[model samples]
Target: MKLELGDQSGRTAIITGANSGLGAQTATALADAGADVVLACRNTDKAAAVANRIGAKARVEKLDLADLQSVRDFADRIDGANLLINNAGVMALPLRRTADGFEMQFGTNHLGHFALTLLMLDKVSDRVVTLSSGMHSLGRLDFDDLNWENRRYRRWRAYGDSKLANLMFAKELARRLEASESSLVSVAAHPGYASTDLQGHTESLMDVVMAVGNSVAAQSAADGAMPTLYAATSPAVRTGGFYGPTKFGGMRGAPGPSSYREVADDEAQRTRLWQASEELVGITSPV
Candidate 1:
């Protein structure tokens, strides 16, 4: 990825999950480029530390995507954001429910960010960058059972579904923006394999696999943050564009356009996902 960053002075950005990992690195880089970076996080203590390191141009706000109320409250408290970076998410884990009683990964990763983006729509001006994953290639959205309410939960599949939703949301939002003649363009990015704390919580065979992969091929968190930065700030990013590392099976290298699953190409399904998201989140967002 290009390490060179263009000037983004006077722009304000809200980066979810900015407490650590790729989010934190992205926040730091944006701040260094003179953008006001808001570290939206569930953990204010960690966020505060990151903000301090980011110098005077940084601020911290509490944002828990897993809770609709939390997302609403966070949106209301902020204003004048030129960018909304949907960088927070969860990965494979045992079956669990969020505060809203939806599957944990689906709730926090897709629905949570889905609701947050709409609530934040009016506040953003330039663009919104939603983070997906390389694993989205394996995802299939079960629209009939979005929460896995009628099916057995598979942790990896749940994670894949959420990531796929991220791409779908990005594309759908781009379409809406175009239809409404809005200035906002929705883009997606993947960090590839990055070594971060997100890997420390796995307690299954997948944990060992993640450990081995990171040790052998993963880049540092700073390197991982580049594709997100590119999507958020690069002039080359187009509406519905997806960016990721381009070498080693997209696990590491320069940030560039990356391939998405054919599953993400269905516009009808994107519309359905949008409708389902609005109903699930209890809000009718303006296009």
Candidate 2:
């Protein structure tokens, strides 16, 4: 069946980092679906513009996933949401700590979204979709150095770790939902090499490499967002499913069932990671 996001009249969605990149495109598509989207972003001004462009039904809400208090505040503001798109994220950036003192990439990419997802679980009814990446294939969880404090930090490695965590979290959350007998669904989607500001965030050397590759291999932000929108709204999507591009190696094509990282299927890691995340974020959801 075609994954169409139309006729979502009274449904509401909260998209983290919805001001730009895949997030912005997803917000626009969801608005087109007739959903009232909350553009949860760090930059209010940029988010406002995105909401304005999407239509007046879109609302801008300030959200910095890096801070627990900010996550709490954002969660509190939500009354009920039909969809929660964990679409906002940070990329390969230099070593920096978030407001909560976690490494920047892991903090913004994984933990921030982790905390937000848990905080908003009760508020969300139908589904939650997390944005992961293909780099997840190369990653292994470093439980010994979860924060990269003792080990030497590299940008791409940290990014891969976070992306891997995203998939793991999505899967684990699905399992938890099943155990709790909750109807809420959790799924993951990735934009394979999409052209977005993430490339601009890279170092100059890597930027040039990405810039060249992007011109040929990357899809536009709107195309990149299709899988996410599909996962969020498609009737055919099953809980715990992953979706992405359907072309060669999933680079670009119509949204479809996507391959997953083998590591994400490790039951032990999924359990351990879930417990650790719950402890770290200090929130326990029936899931």
Candidate 3:
């Protein structure tokens, strides 16, 4: 089923990772719906290519999610953003740290977007959509060692943790928005399993198997982008809602309410994570 995003005229949408994959597809849909899109990416050149294909309604900007300074700089330049899609991320990379020396997946996937969203809260008028994953089911909160500073880093576990954090962040952000009595909403969505270059970085044998499956059975990036666009544009979507595919354990289908591990809904953990994230990112609640 195709996503129907109605008029978004004169509004601006900032989408991270828009140079390719789901982000690019989401940007295309929004631009077609009349929203001016800003592709926030680490490489302006690659993003520019995506922008060219998107035509006049889409533009490019430098945004490195691994670097806090880059987030700050990018937020500084933008005045108003009607939609902020925190869609950029790294999956299971070996053992790499962000520029801020935090665990790569957790830092880039969770904290970077956390900082960016908080910093841009004043400019955002409508919604914030963060991309999570079904792998979040494998995750648990490790409050004492979020950065993996002392723990032995298991790449997949770390990735799961980061995606879990994405959901928690969205829920907490939604709560805060309510507290602040703001009209803006925070939502989360997972693309399920989409065929995209996002899988190219991992070298595990499982990666090879998954790549084969993706080539044979996975949904296209455009289909994978549906849930995110649905959460972003659908009036039926509520604050703190999480969306994904409706079939095959949420691996593929049209957009709907997605299942998440019960642990992800822990209110206390969400609060703790919010506090820890603010501490790690060196700030208080933007709300």
Candidate 4:
């Protein structure tokens, strides 16, 4: 049940938010496999520390997923890569807005990656891997109020919607890539209950709750990242496929096919979300 990575000497991979947690674990694993790794993160200092540890094969780049300009700027500097992992995200938090004035979670988790992937599509020669969540099943998208502008804002629900959007975006991108006859593939993965800094940003009592949960019920960030690495590099992965841990209800174990909410498979919704995302991000779909 172990996931083995073959020679990746010729590959280049860009991973967002690689300063810590699952992103850092994924970056280290790939670099160890001989891939050139780019830690595309907002915090250059932390990312630099990670790159330094990975030695000459890794480099740090500034990428703030909360701002579109940052996303664009990050994409502009990337000449090419074999993989682009849309791995950065925020979890449940009090209502907030991005620089573009979109809901913080939805904006950063989905639209930000949306714009970056499209902007860098031509530069990515192999695949795009997006991170989703087991919590996606609890999400119900109100496209009309995606930004939480007209509704009661619930932090957990907002997080769920964003993660659901992540899954939807990956599948839609895969469909468009196939239709365009492109070699690039899009796949999705989830960490299940990974213990990471991501859960500490809630800025509320839940932070303490999640911290306790992490100590008691979560897997290590390295183990949690296995699904992402498997999706990014595994030949067994299919376009639009989702992967996660195979044991303890998909929370921790070997990587394998993972179940997603049925709503995530709705074709019409996927297309509609894609169209709306394009309009929101002001980018035409390259696929």
Candidate 5:
């Protein structure tokens, strides 16, 4: 079924990484739908440009998900919001660490969003949407080696692990909110092979390969952002549902309920990841 969002007047949404790509598209779409949009980004200049294009309905806020302190500060600054889209993320890169010294992908993609969602949970009146990826099927988390400290680090595998964490975090958060009898819902979505700048940043020859793949197989960033927008705004969305492209092996198509790996449904792993994330970010029992 094609999903179209209704008028969102009186709703406020905060989208991370709103400077470009899917985040930008989602922010623009939501603002056009009459929701107040906050472009929470690391680069104020780029975010400002987007906000300008979005006119008065959009504003910019500086946020660096790689830095836990930045996440805390941003959470503190926002009074309240109806929706929070945890859309900012880093893909495959050389073994690097976040400001808090965790693996960059896992730190920014999962932990940072984890902390931000918890810190801002009380203030959010509606739902939380997190961006995951199709690559999450390839992820296998080793709690002991989550940071790649005990073994060799493969950039793609690390990225997969982070995306998997994003999916599990959403599910676990949904469970907690339900258990706590809160109205808030948590959901996740993936951009199936969308052409975006995320592929151009590997700083390696894979960039060339991905560029070719983008030109040949990927959909537009706006199309990729649809699943996220659907998750964020669709009244039909379930608390823990995952949406994505529903055709061509989930590589590109209209947004819908998409398939996920069996591993993603592991309740034990979801609980463990949530616990581990809480310890890593120094937060507890957020829901």
Candidate 6:
């Protein structure tokens, strides 16, 4: 199936973590659809390579999602983005903290995107697509211990929590956009079990686990990216919707509604998350 990004010609899109994996694929697809793509990444060289591969109209920028200031800097540099793809994220990395001292996974995977989204909200007039995960179903937000400083830190659990936060943020953003009657739309998609370098963060887990998952369950990065592309481009897409692979336990196949957690749809929790996110990021949403 092919994607038609209608009216995308000459439009600009900012894709975080566009240097590799699913983000890179999305960048390519958007470029192919005639959108001018900006590759926001920590590694400028890697991002530049992807931009070059995608050809002209694709440019690279330096961005560190773990630093709020960096996110602000990146936001300040751009104006009028038709699409914002919050695709940059870290996986099961060792316990650490962001530049602001929050748990690294939570800070980078959720809070950073939170800050960036708010900072760029006014400029993002069309849509915002966050990369979420199936692991979010196993996650439950920890309001009391968001940092994991006073609690035990299991890598996967922290990753799961962050992914859940990503979905929650998208859902909440959509609600706010609707309430304000803004043109912006918010949606989310997961890559399911896409094979990518993100596994390097979990090297301690064992190659057999990674290999089996990649071979039996994982889709190619391009294949996994289709859902996000769909959410970003499809006319049938609805705000606050979640999309992912439709095959075996959501491990592969075409774009469709993926199973989401009840907690993710909790309005009270989402509201609290919005407030906490605003306080943490110190950026107010336009809504």
Number of clashing pairs per prediction, in order: 1, 0, 0, 0, 0, 0
Candidate 4, residue 139: the lDDT equals: 87
Taking all chains together, the TM-score of candidate 6 against the true structure is 0.96
- State which candidate has the highest TM-score: 4
Task: Name the TM-score of candidate 3.
Answer: 0.98
TM-score versus the correct structure, for each prediction? 0.97, 0.96, 0.98, 0.98, 0.98, 0.96
lDDT of candidate 4 over 1-287, digit per residue (tens): 34688999999999999999999999999999999999999999999999999899999999999999998888887899999999999999789999999999999999999999999999999999999999998789998998999999999999999999999999989998999999999999999899999999988999999999999999999999999999999999999999999999999999999998988889999999999999998899877
lDDT of 1 by residue, 1-287 (tens): 44777898999989999999999999999999989999999999999999999999999999999999999999888875999999998888788899998899989989999999998898889999999999887788898999999999888888899999999999899989999999898999999999977776657887888888888878999999999999998888899889999999898998999998876878999999999999998989799
**lDDT (tens digit, per residue) of candidate 3 on 177-256:** 99989999999999999998888777788689878988999899999999999999999999988999999989999899
Candidate 6 lDDT tens digits, 1-287: 45455667878889999999999999999998889999999999999999999999899988899888898898888876889999999988888899888899899989999998888888887999999999997677778888898888988899999999999999999998999888789999998889987776665755558867877767898888889998998988899999998988898888888889998889999999888888777877777
Q: Report the CA-based lDDT of candidate 5 relative to the real structure.
A: 0.92
Q: Which candidate is the best by lDDT?
A: 4
Cα deviation at 86, candidate 5, in Å, is 0.7
lDDT tens digits, residue span 195-226, model 2: 99877786658888888888887888889999
Worst 10 residues of 1 by lDDT: 197-206
RMSD of 5: 1.2
lDDT of 1 at 101: 89
Task: Look at candidate 5 and tell me the lDDT of residue 199.
Answer: 88
Q: Write down the TM-score for model 2.
A: 0.96
- The Cα local distance difference test for each model comes to 0.91, 0.87, 0.92, 0.94, 0.92, 0.88
Residue 230, model 4, lDDT: 94
lDDT of 6: 0.88
